[model samples]
Target chain A: MKWIPIILIVGLLAPFSLNTHAEEKSSEWVKVKGMVCEVCAYGIRKSLMKEPEVQDVEVRIKEHKVKIVYKDPKKSLDRVKLAQILEDAGYALEGEKP
Target chain B: MLRLGFFILALLGTSQISVAHPVIFKGGIELQGETQKKDSAFSTTYTFSPYWAVAAQYYEMREPSMSPLGRTFEASTVQINHLLKRWWNEGSQGNIYLGAGAGVFAPQGLPSEFLARGEVNADWESTTLYVAARYIYLHPDFSEDVDFKKLRVGFAPYVLEQEGLNSWFILEWRQMNTEKAEVTPLLRFFFRSVLFELGSSLDGDFKFNFMIHY
Candidate 1:
């Protein structure tokens, strides 16, 4: 009866530990905003091509955002670098974290 | 006399009055001829559509080289047709409609013509043109030597498109009653809310047709 509490605690902590370790291994993603038309969406997709680790990039005009899926977990795409490229092309990028 | 009888036959076999309500009705004229002797003729139609429609037509012919009727003869007729396929829109252009209807005929228009005719037709559309092939059963009221069955084909092209303030061209072709073909080319003028056609057929036959639409 005393071991029951210990088993419950171990079962609950196991999932949290696995999740924390996965978060450590996988790079965090920040969806860049500001896409209103086909041209704006294509511009963001073109800028994403410079990142070698970017596995795929998709821009949703309805939500005005771009999702950058990356293959490498150790290295994340720099948002500041992407924001500068967007600024040069007459657009504002937001919700990006270093 | 044989020609007039056949015109009535075509009308009775084709005109069915199931869809004749007072508000919307469709009608038109089709005449065919070439040179001087007009060979064949048929048309005026109203369709409630695939479920219901009625059509009427006329046919006349005179061959001086074959029949002893000189070069002057005429047969005018009116027939009602019911469509085999129903509920099709009556005003849509470029659709071939197949149907059957029956109507009566009074054979007294042009002298030396006799016969009341009934017919069924395959009416179809080709781009801006409408064509029909009809099989007419003829019954002569007077005892004159005319054939019992007359096969006819008719064509009318480009019924729409107003060109240059109501001036447009129409081409019509028909083979009727006997095995003779007639081709008529006409120019239509729409003025004062009325349509008028001036043309000549292959047999040196010339005439004018007029109609008014409300």
Candidate 2:
């Protein structure tokens, strides 16, 4: 009975505790290539939305740019992982690697 | 005004935008439908690669039809088109596309035949103004070939969102084969995934066109 009470309390508080540890604000302006049409913009946005860390996305069709905001202040995301996600969605970075 | 406009597009489409950007991006699916008088067609295209796409279209005539097979007939087309190249100038925002398409014309009650198509398209756009022109040729096995052309100039009176509604005022001219040219000023509106155009020609004829992308 004692173990059961402790386990219940820990399970209820784990998610809330984890949320407070790595609270960081990060934003990046991703220059995406081959976005000449509206569908291209939509597809890029949709693919970026799949990232659990991503909280906001703005796609500029004419400029071929995608602005992304990722949550979690302490832990920054990997640029290579972001590039892979974009490539799988049928697009590439505009200027340089990552 | 119309004659001056036509001359400008003819000059620009021949030597301009085609040099900038040629092809749209890969991984796009477009569905288009057009109805004129008693004839209508539904077409859908899926881009399989960066510069290649397969298109399927079904056209039908309801009444007073002028089809190669008969007055009333149904036809379908399956084509594969590719963007050959694109050109962009040092300080230009518009691009040009040159593409070729080869397809089969399957008319009901007749043998399926092959057709070849060549098209040149150019467009220049800004925050408010958009101008586009395209010339297309369809060469069939029979003498019933087609020279189709389109010119459109649009102005946006309002700002639009990516996932919301956008509206534009477009003046368009379309010529189909040997018929008289049709000129209309239409209201072009689009949401995130759907586009609709409605207008009327000077002769009181109404026009409706729709397109969807996924």
Instruction: Note the DockQ of each predicted structure.
Output: 0.01, 0.07
Q: What is the TM-score of each candidate against the true structure?
A: 0.36, 0.65
lDDT tens readout by residue for model 2, A1-98: 87998999999999999987655658778776545445446666766777788887888765667888877645455667777666545556654342
Runs of candidate 2 with Cα error greater than 4 angstroms are: A1-25, A31-40, A50-55, A60-65, A71-98, B1-25, B60-75, B85-93, B106-112, B161-163
Q: What is candidate 2's lDDT per residue for B7-35, written digit by digit as tens?
A: 23322221111111233335556666666
lDDT of 1 at B98: 37
- Report chain A TM-scores, every model: 0.58, 0.65
Count clashing residue pairs per candidate.
52, 10
Q: Which digits, one per residue and each the tens of the lDDT, describe model 1 over residues A1-98?
A: 99999999999899988876544223343444433233334445555656687777765543445667778765555657766655433244565321
Report lDDT (Cα) of residue A68, candidate 2. Answer: 86
Worst 10 residues of 2 chain B by lDDT: B12-21
Task: State which docking tier applies to candidate 1.
Answer: incorrect
Query: Which run of 10 residues does model 1 chain B get worst, by summed lDDT?
Result: B15-24
Go through the candidates in order and give each one's C-alpha lDDT.
Answer: 0.42, 0.59
